[model samples]
Target: MNSLALKGNPGDGERMAIMSGRHQAFGLWGLLLLIVMAHGCAPGGSTEVGPRAPVPPVSAVGLAPDEPLRVVATTSIVADVVRNVGGDAIALTQLMPLGADPHAFESTPQDAGVISDAHVVFINGVGLEVFMDRLLASAGGNTPVVTVSDGIRLLAFAGEHADDEALADEDHGEDDPHVWFDPNNVKVWVANIESALSELDPDRATTYRENAQAYLAELDALDGWIREAVTVIPEDRRGLVIDHSVFTYFAHAYGFEQVGTITTGGSTLSQPSAREMAALQEAIVDHGVRAIFVSTTVNPRMAEQLARDTGIQVVPIYTGSLSDASGPAGTYLAFMRYDVGRIVEALR
Candidate 1:
């Protein structure tokens, strides 16, 4: 009966304390079966998927009038977006704690309880929540799960090494899941969130649309700011090497080349082997990469070691999670601004 407690900000109208219980073996088996089934039905079943039509807005016939719509978001970033759109109209709960890694987050019984009582569960949903299947099964509910990344075109893993071909293919043979690296993709997320929330609670439809529009304008300004900020770095110096492959979308949008990563594939859970490490170090030296960008959610030991070996600097950036309430990256907008400033400074 292991217990996990996550503290929320009282000022933000968030739950102050959440208690989650460990899952039993039966639930684990059910989760595994669900994953297997999803994998079997996936297009190409470990290969790239072609472009598809944009995800249609979700519509609801009616809403419960007893109280606000009970909404659950899997990650803080997702929760923040929902908060912006839903405002004071919805009862939203974020599942993951501050700075928790979504890729490796294991759900407890309390998390299940929260999910079971929710009207809708929102997730980043490009394989970002690796434990989501188990969490949903443990919760045992028919709550609609909404994926915020539904409409964006996904990027595949880049620069695969010969030694890591199998691992890369097995782990990330499909599109990369870190779409939020580009602010434009987040615009898509906002649209999805606004539509979902409006549908669930139709009475607040006007408010949701208004809030979403305001946020979209902010996102537009953010995209412009990133472009201007990136112009400080020279074209040749715009090479990025990070802890993991998290910047594909960012690089694509900003005209930077992804030199390499400390860990292979998209997920931080995958480890870099000796040969892979050696290869990355060599590439860094060859490309004259100035610094290695690491995520706050992941351990910096390996990145630090690589920096020591190559005589480069190690800069920590927020990746999978946001910072604590008082930190620099407490919000998604702040997170991107801080990270981009760090990246431009390091590269320039």
Candidate 2:
């Protein structure tokens, strides 16, 4: 996929057009109405996510004018952000397909080829793409790359994760890479994306700016709505027990308490020891936590075990990727809606 920009032909426009429009519409009407009313439907839905390994951005510098910007996203969540902001101006290849975990993902030679040839690449940054250093070390792309979450107020992850080998990769000091958990942070993603795309392909600047403005407004509305919805939960109930330390940004943004996690690492590559699980279960019971939120991309077995042992309910929601076009979380906006609604539901 060393093509610059992406090939605009969606293989099937009728399907893709409907998919695109519907995905765009997923939360617009309600979110718009919510902006006025200070409310919107709570999070609800799921989506498929990204690939197995990190690939270098494949540059397609000499492709035809009709060829869209060849962009490679480290994760599907990042891909959706670029798509919403870049619109039809670029062709994006998600290095990690839906459902693949980024924290533990490995990069292959082919993946490196994809990274090396892109005209512009969007990464979540904040050490999220642990494979990035090696990928860049290999000189994967001539494509200009930018981190969408570059200027975000990255959250500090003090908890433990599952992947130790990748732990060294997150030497990002204290900044958290899971900024998408906070809509405001994702708004930063829009800006970085729009700036990169506009600069990379000046011809599409108008489109990129226009889309970014609109998407950014939506993000703001989402943040406001979250503030409103979260108000419904009592302070004591405004706490979360998650599988990994994935919700630090989300919790921080929404005024929720991070009581702790079943696993202590930044990634889910590790398993909780019997003692760790017992401790987390005790924590849940101690806090009277109503729910344990687990990302849909991962099995909730550990969470379920903890929930059962601690008498907490496990709620499944989209954390990484949007669902297939047929499901509720078919896009980034929907992914947020799905998650926030679930959180609102269990807590309220």
Candidate 3:
């Protein structure tokens, strides 16, 4: 995976240059000079200058001439929702592929071109896409970035999650990016997407609003369905064992407690230490967790091993990304229903 970590490393200066959004051109001669002079000073002596494409500024509302609004969504989950709101008025591109972990996602050079071409880029944000800065810099850093998770109150990592090893190297502070797990929060996303699209192309404001309204209704229904579905699991049995803290919003909204996590934190990038694993296994047993809910994006080997040791089932749940159109959990609505059904079955 060609990813740029947000840490104080030797390559930090070079990465900073890419992120600075300079219109300077590093011609062949300049690239060679940098390679020769900054060999040991610059990290890895990278001479690759990003595309300095000039992005056109967005006009005020009502710029809709004929071409559909070009939009980019960072994750498949975000793409699905953006599609719901954009409907036929926008040309949408999804950045992440199916079942890809957002935390550890690799950004390709082609992605930079895609983002540069977009009128606006929609992301889950709140620090979910760690590689976004590099990708945006590579794209020339001119596209307007919209965070759909805005307006929703984000949660902070508490107790053991506050000290997660995955976050030790990150100054991510305490905003949980997994707000989509709660349908109520998704309603906020619908509003934000609608607002962005309407502001960009006011000619189709009514269409965007209608699409948002319909999707908002569907989201409300999903919320109610989840509320009813989780009731099948008795209150005491609502303790959940997950691979990570991805379901913090789900548990908080649905009355389930995350009894233990295999990865020991909110990110799949973190590995569990032996002592942490032992403690989690003990918690699972003590809490009487029936199943270990593993995300389809992350490796299930650790989850499977833990389940074996505890004699519990490993249930796969969609997180970060969605399945293809042909599979279960293909749409955002279907994803919630499928996960809730699995959770209900496992604990009921």
Candidate 4:
């Protein structure tokens, strides 16, 4: 697809220039595999998924004779986080395949088996999961379920004229589900993950503790690094006007305020009305916003048009899922880093 470059302010070119150095998605995935290796063994014991995986949807999970704990996570992001804590003792099934969108993912029969047989299910709850209710009902499991983001302090989508209870849209909620975007908020998720995984597999409590501790230290460093990086933007310039409410968590965690979103509600599936678009356009001019951060999971054409109409630059970033383990936003940590780098570089 040929991209029509939208020109904005002159200095904006420098930011877009650096963004142009984007890694090829496949190549970045190769580098991502290496990074995961340093973090120690991935969860679910083995990397070798069977030649023909016979994952059933939700059914009655019977006893496994000396089998590992069966755990299922909703997305690769949740899977990666659980893998860190579960380490080698858990058999985890990720419902959504790599590079899939969590917001609008449809559950399948195999997914039923994953949820059915799992001793526990983990989800990034905060209304982030649109398929949770149906997936749970489909799974038909008796497993104790846990929401990793349940206990974390949450921020409301800070759009003045935005509705907080817009449930009609599927992909997003009034609350931002991208808490994992902020490493600190993820630390809260880790605490919940460690507790849930440990309760299921007490024998490996030490491993979970060790993994969680190490991961937390990295998160601590991540928080520090984000602050340092964000400082690149002058204090007064730290405001955001985004394609959707996707960056609400990131902006809140960092020091930026989300002045407005293109979509009137939390969901990306909802299109912006002409009236809403007009309002957003005005906000862009008022805020002196340099660029609009758009999610690659959804279509960026709307944002592109907004950029063209206003001469405000639009920069693409990974929000919902990591790039295929070979791209810039492959891992959770790297995904946040990549996004933050792009946001800071452009806004600063």
Candidate 5:
């Protein structure tokens, strides 16, 4: 069409210009609206998801005939319990390497691949696996996960600032994750593992049950042994000073008091302030703590310094991960035995 003629009243021309400008503005706004709608096609047409939601727990599904149930465990400790229950019926992959600190674990692309291929993943869940959310996202977010510590009650961090039960958060972030320190908790782990395996491979349910029963018996025996062994330490001298709050369950189960921790909180990822260190040193002297128990996975620089400052020994224990099969703490059972024996010797 020909352009509209401008030979009109001046006022009329000005009005037409205003109308044309309005049309252009409306066109721009319409284009922007379409772009926003395109991007906002998520549920409820909301574009922003804010923070990522935690990976939800998935249920295990039974495998086909004679097919091995593929399993991935977050740590070597968790893998050992699953190994005890699943036996030879499942193909297991442990994500964190041996002796790696679980609180500071970083997942790799290969770990994501291993997780993605698994039928079920086992974890010592109470905010223990810090890399789990991103790792699960990388693994397509659909892998079944069994938290071995599900049924057992979690102990919260008895920080200097708060009481134990008072520190329990809605997310249980302050709760302790080192439940395997107590053999009874490991019995719960064995039961959870057996149930998950039985659901995943029902044909071998009998075998899983049998293995779980045997392991439970072993755990009971270990529990009895720990009770008897801790008796060697005089009641008045049973105070524990550790690198961090990793031994709450151990203390609670074995009648020892966690006199002090170098780190201020449950996580070793946290740093101890100068004030906190001074206070811990004072507590050590006040409580007559004999040694500073440190985890093999954690750096002993601070613990060594603390030991020097306090004139006590630094006892290295396995907390986060297990050692190789040839090592002293290769298995969970052996790990507890080694740690307890060291604790007894240090405190007795």
Candidate 6:
């Protein structure tokens, strides 16, 4: 992955000169450089010479006539949100593949290429993308990286999650990154995405705003549906036992307590000690948690073992990434519905 910064105000002649020099030094690699350079030279391309420029609104940036804005999202879930806002106005690429765990995802060279060519990048930022710093370093460019969770109230790690070794190892501070668990929070994401997309392609500002408004309505409906579905389960039985602290936002929003987890942290990469497992099992039995919700992105062996020991069912849920096109939880809306329905079925 090339780590060259591509955000300068170079004229076309200077760009051609740079491309020619690159071609002489590196063969086909220079062609890739040229493509990236061409993207940077597009309308709204960074024109600053030294220090990074303040992030400009999409309206401030100019796009070439008929040129689609180039965008990149760190995960499938984020990609879907951007897709809803940008619609066909932007060429978007998802860095993480479907079903990839965002917590532990490492960007490939191809991903770096995509990021390098992007005019803007969207992420679920609350320390969720552990590889983000390194990935950004590798895909060095002045592409504005937007954190969709920017203004949403963040939930701090508490209770049993406070002592998690993985959270400590990753230095995730106190805030949880699984904000998408609540549709209301995703509404915040939709607004941020629309704002960024409009800033990048102001000509499509109306279109982006319209798309965001429609998606926000869908998210509102999803929130109400989740509330209604959750009510079927008795309040006392609304405890959630999961593979990780992935449901903190969901539990908070839908009036459920996150009783315990197979792993001790917010990330699936965390492993539980024997003491942790014993404690989790005890909590499961004591709290009468009927199901252990396991994420499709993580190995379910530990969760299955816990369920077997506790005599409870192991329910699979989508987290970190969306299901493939042929799967039930393919889109963000479908993913939430599927997971909420599963939760209702398990405890109701």
Best by TM-score: 5
Cα lDDT tens digits for candidate 1, 1-348? 101111111111100111122222334233433433211122222222223222223456365675788899988988988898988888999999988877657778899999889878888877677666666666773566777887788776454241244443443244677889999999998988888787767888999999999999999999999999999999889889987778889999999988888665556655544555666777798888999998888778778877987899999999989888799998899999999999999999
Q: For residues 154-215, could you state the per-residue lDDT of candidate 3 as single tens digits?
A: 77532234444655556645556688999999999898788878878888889999999999
Which 10-residue window in model 3 sums to the lowest lDDT? 1-10
lDDT per model vs. reference: 0.73, 0.65, 0.72, 0.65, 0.72, 0.72
Tens-place lDDT per residue, model 6, 9-120, is 2111011000011112323233433333211113232212333334322334667889999989888999998999889988988888998877656678877778778888
The 10-residue segment with the lowest total lDDT in model 5: 11-20
Worst lDDT 10-window in candidate 1: 1-10
lDDT (10s digit) by residue, model 4, range 1-348: 101111111111011000111122333233433443211112222112112212222222344556677888887888888887787778888878775666556678888777777787777765556555556666663555677776667665555343323322432223555678778788987888887666666766788899999989988988898888898898778778776677677777777878777654454544444455566667777887888888777666667776887797889888777788788877788887898899888887
Question: Is candidate 3 or 5 superior in lDDT?
Answer: 3
lDDT of 2 by residue, 1-348 (tens): 322222221111011000011112223233433333211112111111223233333322455668788888888889988889888778888888777667556678788888777776677765566566666546543445676776676556633232224444644344555678888888888887887676667777799999999998998888888788778888889778887667888887778877767545455544444444555555577778899988776667667756776677899887766788788888887888888889889998
Q: What's the number of clashes in each of the models?
A: 2, 51, 0, 11, 0, 3
Candidate 3 wrong stretches, greater than 4 Å: 1-64, 158-173
Model 5 Cα lDDT, one tens digit per residue, 3-112: 11111111110100000111112342344333332111121211122244444344446577778889998889999989999988889998889978887677889898
Worst-scoring 10-residue span by lDDT in model 2: 11-20
TM-scores for every predicted model: 0.80, 0.76, 0.80, 0.77, 0.81, 0.80
Which scores greater on TM-score, model 3 or model 5? 5
Model 4: how far residue 144 lies from native, Å: 2.3
